[model samples]
Target chain A: MDEIIRINHITKEFRVPDRHEGLRGSIRDLFSRSYHTVHAVDDISISIAQGEIVGYLGPNGAGKSTTIKMMAGVLEPTSGEILVNGCVPYKNRTRNAQNIGVVFGQRSQLWWALPLVESFRLLKDIYQITDAQYDEMLALYRSLVDIEPLLHKPVRQMSLGQRTLSDILAAFLHDPKIVFLDEPTIGLDVSMKAKIRTLIHELNRRKNTTVILTTHDMGDVDALCRRIVIIDKGKMLYDNDIEHLKKFFGAYRTLKLRVKGDLSEQAKRIAAELPECSVSANENWISVLVNEDKQKVISVLSQLQKSYDIRDMQLEEISSEDVIKRIYEGGVV
Target chain B: MKRKGFRFYLRIYFKILAQDLKSKMSYRADFIISTVGMIFTNIAGFVSFWIMFRNFPSISGYSYHEMLFLYGFSLLSVTPTQCMLDNNWNLRQQVYSGDFIKYCFRPINLFFYYESEIFDAKGLGQLAFGIGTLVYAWAKLGLAVTPLAVLKLLVFLAGASFVMAALQTAAAASCFWIENSFYVLDLAFRFRDYAKYPITIFSPVFRFIFTYIIPIAFIAYYPGMMVLRPSEVSLLSWLSPLIGAVFFYLAYRFWMYGASKFNSTGS
Candidate 1:
């Protein structure tokens, strides 16, 4: 794939005033000055290719937003370089902005009291879209996002989901080559989230728009992105295919078994025999942790059946949350 | 594309301004009351001057009507920049809220974006009243309608607006380091209050300061002085607007420097 964004050893640091907490401390803080330097985005390097939907995964204060801000031309890196579409974003903001679209989920860019249509008209003027192009793009967005019902509604009157959808549409109205979405489905309901995800997939497939999405939801990653980049403490910890991420960190599955009678002795024996598995028994239910290579759950059940009647058996795939927790706790990847 | 640039920015500006007005109009009573209140406040300011002038025959060799011409012109000249560009006045909030991020990615100039957000109907109303007051003062004073005087006034007004706008922009840009710019803006306002009256009333040192350093005299006193007393139209009078323009350019440079600092600091 052709490279669409090339971020080379980008670093961003901030100097925040060091202030004491109390009233007395505050008065002293006015006269006595101190500052603490925070490295919001360290010397990090990553590149995204054309038609790529990269999932940028991180917890809060993990520099995901800062990185995005730099790429979006909202922030300048303290040192190092970032070139989006062969243009340094902060240095050539107008040209960079023409080729890029950015959406911040927490803020609505639409005019608050104006109808969605009016905002679109203003955007067309701001972006200098031709009349025909504006019409075609608006029609396309209306159909894709089903924004017909929302066209006449004032932005402040629209629901969060509606507003978010409109914001996404507004971002794409310029037909930008790259779109940066920060928490695009942050506060949406399950159905709205699915709709947004589907819309994003469709947009990518049809337009081949390069997308960089920063989201907290793992489902957003699983459903949309084939690649994932994870960062923590202003450093990139993982940057590769999603499957590789899962393979490296997303190991271990759970086996939950329900038996008919009290089988504490049998459970203990099984726990002792299967040293690789973690066995937990509560009341009539027993849960066993199994490695990825061990899939003969039937054999374990058969052995358990010799001592106690098996009432119900179920197997569950290890969730991504558990994988992340294990990664954090074990420092595995 | 070059020809279209100004029209493009102006179109977007008016569209945004219209939206702001509509939003304000949603509170119909508040809009009306505020507009009326602004007119009353301006009238009160002029009334206080009238009362003061009644006791004193003249101030610094200028009569009441002549001073009103200066005051009215200064108020009118700065109104558009103040009312339209006042959004830049909230640089403190913009910094704290990280709202400047929005401007960085826009395909327009940051100055235009900063000015557009605060375009309110109340401001438009004030601007209209200011212009009206200027015309009334001109007619009452029987100021000359010579082409040269009109040309000078227009240049002076444009230059004054640019300087005022740039100063506010510089103050707002201070948010990069200070995080709160309102105090700086407040101080700038106090400094600007000296321009409300004639610079002739001040000492030679102060006159020099207003003319060369802060340069508020270019907005009203200098141009008005040149027009009302054509005998004083030296080369300096014609060059005063250039000083304002230079100050405006410097202020713009200061704003760009602050923005770079902000970008480096990140959100």
Candidate 2:
């Protein structure tokens, strides 16, 4: 599929007032004006194909939201161009809005005091969605999240999880060609996050939806995004797939072993034997970190298995957070 | 495409209206208290004027009953504008709270979006009180309610409401640039109080500022003058609505200009 969203050298500048401290200065500020220019989104360019779930990751204050707002047509860039589905989002805001679905975390488009279904119906009317299309979309989302029980409940009365679920469903109700999910799982519990991830995955696969997901949670990136884009200080740091990132950092693996008998003695012996490896243990759980180049994971497990019965073991992929942190600290280890 | 566009916006407008009403109704105490407070405010204004007229039979070539009609006309004109433009007053807070961002994604005019955000239940109370005052004053004055007179009243009120709505909306839009527009809106709405009284009561400079610079005096005062006074000089009051329309257009243009500079403040 062709590129559904293309951001070309876009920059957003904000002229913020530099206010002085103290009550006297605040009163003086009422009469005088002083401003400092802030480059909220520096020159950044990106392109995404249809049905691609691109994880737009960044630390806070890195212009991730500025870029998303520009894409979502809620903001205008100071310079350069942005094309979403061949329409300049700022110049053709209403037209671009017709083709885009935007959810800014838990902040919702649903009417707060109305029932969830009432909000959906209002959206249906505003978007001019047909009855058949509305029913199909509602049925499909209901299957994913089971929103039927919550449909009669007012949005203001819902739990955070239920509200976020309803918000995600409302974002896709019109079935826009492209969707922007801004920190969709921010305050959600683990299970709620999993449900949201599943919804995104299913929606993208079934509807060929082009998704741009901005998230701070590494697990969300690991689960839902194949291609990752890391941005910091309003600059693009890296744009590559998970495989490419793992290629450099994935060599080091952590093995979490549950020894049924004598956990600390085995943990001590392993730490003493493998001086290079880091070992930490609880009452029954032993965490053994090993680099494949120095000492293979299989050998470490074999060595541990001889004395201690490995009741259960877990092999963890290097977390996306550590990978990004490593990249930030020492440039793509 | 034209019909579709019109119908689309109209549907969205009512949908937002419905939601606003529901949200207001949910806060039962706030809703009930605000409505009752508005009714009392109009009553106090009427009683204050009644006391003033009771002491002095006339002021500046206007009788007690004529002054009541003038104030009632102003109230009718101002109350609906206050109701319709409630969103404009709240625009500063909306921008601060990031609710303004959602409005940009709608397939509707930005001004239309602001219009839809407004649905004040308190305005119903004000409306009831205003009509009651206007009828009482009209009956006391013993003026005939001719078809032409009724039509004139509506046209002038529409013009007055437009002027008030446009100014308040423009003041709110200024919040996008100024960040806080409490003073600007306060000044705009407070300045409008001059229209409730006769322009002749103020100094020549005040008359010029209100009549020419702001043109609010034309909104209710001059129009009310035409209805109640009806002298040869009162013929000039017939031009109030047209003058109001021009000022309203200018205010809308100012609002759009301010909106173009919006920075979307923060997260």
Candidate 3:
């Protein structure tokens, strides 16, 4: 649980020229230049520990990529400090890069025209990996990600899923202590997504590699991360364990009731009698939001059954997507 | 580490260069056509000068062969810098596409990333043409072939390449602020135009500026003067290359500063 990364009050701003539309405005812009500052990453701080897979969740343009770039030393913070493995990422980039790996899902770090193995070899030279160590890591990556068919194929010819898998493998081949994966499984099929998730989990468990992942896929969060940090509008809204997030903001659970003899009125009365529930009727099924604890699920179902002949019933727990939607809509936690 | 260890990096660098060459060779016909086209384009400039010299016989106090020496050496000094550092010419695209990120994470000096991609097939063609022109000028001018003159010429050529590479790198590094300043590269080559002739034809102050401020004269004129053993070629001729070396160092420092700015701006 030792801290591997410490980001303290990091902020980034960009000065963008103000340009107007049309020919006249373009001419004026050329002569009299003006600019406005964009606050891409606001003052924010978060620390991640060793072997922890934390979900950095945010919508597009919410500064997720900016933060990852800063952490990876691809960009410097406008203000404040970032320390990875006890070194400033920007000032000591080469030293910091030696122990860290990064992958941007939108871009391939692998050489586009070369075979995947060739790109890996180039990386080995760039990172100065020993021959034995390179072979060992290549073997491990091949076993974990099914990269055998991919090693010989040119990167330009590989499918998106194949390329993504290769990219993930390349990022970890150097045995970096900490890896930043930005949308690692983006644009992948269901099976590919599952395979990547398993590979990530295996890497973390086997190597104790700290991972910081920024993804729009909620399934990625549910499947891999035990902790989550959500940011929006360049501000951190929540940072805690997944269970706490579900408990704090996961307010409503759905109950689906199917009753006999069109007993719609009786179901409504039953729902009304239970003040904690909100009722909605559709066809022969009545749906209710049970606001009480899940312990009350049985009681609520029994009450509905006693009043009306129950044909079938179903219950669903609140999902992470629902929790995120509520948070985005400014729901109280 | 020992000085020999630096050679290891250079060896690896050439491997990468070989890989790039292989990739470029994939387009075989285009490569051949471009190589031929480059020779024709360079010859066109010399052809214009030959026609001018044929009519007038001399420009100011210099003859045709003497001017060819200046032209040939200037082009020769520039080819090594331009061809080896071709990546600098595309710095605008690198900045716009964020490919600079690749260099930021590497354990090597970022300057090498900008320097290594400079050599390509077109540059090799230019180098061939420059050398051919130099040999032609040497034979026609009846230039003195003393061992000392040859030694000084080699030293001057090396210093000239260093200075030219540094200037090109500085021009490329300016893209960090201006973003898409490929025009700066164009401006640099325009100044190279000044090196195609002897600086002795200009006023003293103009000569000093080209030699000291821009150091274009170091790349061609001073070296040409040293080889020709002109009376004006004093001890100052030997020291002029130091100007090129110092400018190279300053340009390198500026490139690092610009890289730092890129890291902060992230544009």
Candidate 4:
């Protein structure tokens, strides 16, 4: 519950040269170059505490990376203040870096051609980590995951999942007070994602390490984060626990049907019969959204069954993914 | 974290350099071929000097063998920069690709981390060729082989290498602001060719720029003078170590400025 990160009205703006299109435009631009400002991160503020895994959620080009970069001391905010571990991140980057770890997905921090442990040793030296701390962390890692087989495997040969897992472990090796993971599970498989999520959860629990993860995968958020902060167009839209966010969209129920016949026709019939429900089809499943408050899901399902020979049907509650999708689609803040 | 002492960083530097060398050795054939190719490249430069000497024996009041000494000294002085700081040559590409942000994540000096990422094996070839030429020139010119003289040569080589590394680092750091700083580094490297000959051959203005502005003349020209013509050498020529330290400090400051102003590329 102790405050470890305090961001107050932080804003990061970038001035980019206005480039011209054609050769003549380019030549004209060379003579009188113009520029425009991009508000990559608008005035946003959030306070994070120790031992909390908060999901920093945003769409592509939604300034997720820009915000994470500012928090990591990679970029200085243009306005307002940010204090991590009682120091301004950009002002005291090296000192802040000692207490924080970062994993920028799609970019491996490990030595490309060296064994995984070599990068770890170099990091140990870089962080000036004591031998006891290093060995203890190693022991914890070995217990949680089967990384012994990977200790000597070169980073270049590892699959994407292995590399990402190693990167996450490396970030936590220093026992940093906070770790910023930008899309850590971005391109990982379900099992790999589960493995990484478990690792992050265990580390946060055991070491009391704060975790700030930016990811589009709702599964990642659902599995690891208790609190979720959603941003769009450089603005913070929502910040609360996942349960509260789900409560906001509690009126809707997803009715999934495993149909054997014409999916589109069945979808059309369902939509026509139930004017209040929103319907969509993919492959052999027709998913119809029913507002439970407006009409019970049972009534909607029974009504559709009378018209079409629905092979099978089931109902699902609105997930965090649905809430986020609705928010991104301009539903509500 | 509090800043550690010099010895701590020095230890990390060698550790990372060893790791880098081990990684480079993974592609054994590529390493061997590139190292050999690097030596051949220097040999090709020497062969050009040989052909020119064959025609005129000397171009600027210096004999063929003396120019060899100058060329050998220039190569030896630059080996440190070539071998250690070769990663800077890729700074522009890394910046464009957003790979430069990797340095920001580490709890180490950005410039040191960037430079320590690689140790160019090709510099070994340059070192081998430079030593070979220096020994050959030493025997031919009948220069004294005193222990003090050898020690002094090493001190001068260290200073000259620092100057060259400083210049290259400063040029490469400009990539943080400019679109392509390799062009600026290339321009700096063109001045390196001037160090292969005596500063006396150039006009006074060129001599001034090489000595004052760029200070590349200290790399080989002035230091060569101290070894070849000790009586003719002035007091200024002996300031290679001081000049190197000053230029390195300035360049490091310049690099820090660029790093502060760096606008990382989009993710």
TM-score top scorer: 4
A169-247, model 4: which lDDT tens digit per residue?
A: 9999999999999899988888999999999999999999999999878788889989999888888888888787766
For model 1, the stretches where C-alpha displacement exceeds 4 angstroms are A15-37, A248-325, A328-333, B1-4, B22-27, B203-213, B233-236
| lDDT tens per residue, model 2, A1-333 | 798988889888888888989998898888997999888888888899999999998888889988988887778888999899998888887788878888878677777788998888887876778899999997887677777789999998999888888887888888998889989998888998898899999999988999899998888888888999988778777888978886777788879998766888778977998897889899857888788888899988887788777789999876766566667877762
Q: Between 3 and 4, whose lDDT is larger?
A: 4
Task: List residue ranges in candidate 2 displaced over 4 A.
Answer: A18-36, A252-292, A295-321, B1-7, B22-31, B233-236, B264-267
lDDT tens per residue, model 3, B1-267: 122258767876886777667766877998899899988989898899788888988877888888988888888888877677777777778777877665665556788855664456697877887888888889898877889778887888888887787778788888988855888877877888888888878899988888777777777887667776567686656775776788789898998888877766643
TM-score of every prediction relative to native: 0.85, 0.86, 0.83, 0.90
Cα deviation at A63, candidate 4, in Å, is 1.9
* lDDT agreement with native, every candidate: 0.79, 0.80, 0.80, 0.86
Write the residue-wise lDDT of candidate 1 on A22-123 in tens digits.
999999999988999998888899999999999998778889989988887767788999999998988778778888888888688777788899899888
- Chain A alone, TM-score per model: 0.83, 0.80, 0.80, 0.89
Q: Quick one: ranking by TM-score, best first?
A: 4, 2, 1, 3
In terms of lDDT, the best-performing candidate is: 4
Question: Total clashing residue pairs per candidate?
Answer: 0, 0, 6, 1
lDDT of 2 at A152: 93
Query: How high a TM-score does candidate 3 get?
Result: 0.83
Q: 1 or 4, which is superior by lDDT? A: 4
Worst 10 residues of 4 chain B by lDDT: B258-267
* Per-candidate iRMSD: 2.3, 2.8, 3.2, 1.9
What range of 10 consecutive residues in model 4 chain A has the weakest lDDT sum? A316-325
RMSD to the native, candidate 1?
4.9
